[model samples]
Target: MPVSTVSIPVGQWFTDDSGRWWFDSGSLALDFAYTGAIRVTVAPETLHAPDDLTGWMRERFPMPVGVARSRDLFDAVSLRDAIGRLALAAGRGEELRAADIDLVNLYAATPDIPPTLGGGSRQAGRSVQTVGQALSTIARDAVDCFGPANDGRVRICAGGCGIVYLDTSRAASRRWCSMQRCGNRAKVRAHRARKSGKVALTAA
Candidate 1:
């Protein structure tokens, strides 16, 4: 039988870095690359390439990319980048600054998926905890493979990436990075509920 799924919650939402992660990791119009039909697996060397990072940045967080453009393809690269970077940093015990964390959070939040590779939380952290659980697995695995934070480098090297989706304050109670997509969705739902007077709302 197949392996059991991990739990993913909606509010279990995570931030990769800070601002970057806050944005829901935007994508482009022509994201055929993200279709489940594509068959690719994780390769260590290719993923670690500076080229990969550059290409990914251009693809998902392109200068032209924005919330309107946010799509599944963006999730593919971003989700991969996030988990991979975190795994690397965690493995080496690198101090993941905002930059580093942003990458991973993006990774976790993207990838709606063909069902094989981790596309992160579809439930946003609710459906049996599938998506959130996958991210947790990635983080936990990263820590197991990488190690504890080293000399606060996770904050420097990772830099804005680490804090992009996270709050910079002592409370640090931020998750997605923006109130646009998920947050707005929640608001819309609440507003609709108030208007319709629905006692219960379906999960997003």
Candidate 2:
């Protein structure tokens, strides 16, 4: 049976140290894309509304799923918390304690539901292993980021968005998550400050 498509709402995504598709926003305490698909919890007042979890999962991963269960959601939140801390530590060039690594690895090693042949048009069914796959992928990426080959590319955005990304720029000088987003906003603010200074000088 074809899974019904729900109206997947638009969400803001930012790359974190753990993965390239991490959801992020200044408005959201945590990315709804991650929280909704993984069923994680954020502040109650956060703007992340996970009304259409099925559609949300489809938009990101190929795993078939209905609404996420509460237990899975809790687990996702826990794993995400560890990922956030590890990413932050990497961004700051700080050491990661063994406990932090262990937490991430524990989630990463979650056994995936074996894919089985589905009747008719369904090639293989994910059952409910989507969450496991997602968590493991995050763990693998985190491991890579800590490796020497990619560690130098890790950077925390200076724009205060609290986002982390691998700087793939040729100059390795990429700062904010995007030149059009946080970077441009910072430039505009600086310009306004210069203008304000000039006006004050004239008045003086």
lDDT for each candidate structure: 0.33, 0.52
The prediction achieving the highest TM-score against the true structure is 2
lDDT of 1 by residue, 1-204 (tens): 112122121112232222222232111111111111112221123333434434433343212221222233344345445544553344245555677565444443443212233456553322332232333333332232222322222221121222222123344333432555445556777798796665444332
Worst 10 contiguous positions by lDDT, candidate 2 = 1-10
Per-model clash counts, in order, read 57, 1
Clashes of 2: 1
What's model 1's lDDT at 39? Answer: 24
Residue 68 lDDT (model 1) = 21
Q: What TM-score would every model get versus the actual structure?
A: 0.25, 0.59
Which pairs clash inside model 2?
39-73
Q: Which tens-of-lDDT digit does each residue in 17-68 have in candidate 2?
A: 4234423331111233234222223212221333333344455555565555
* Candidate 2 segments exceeding 4 Å error: 1-56, 111-128, 190-204
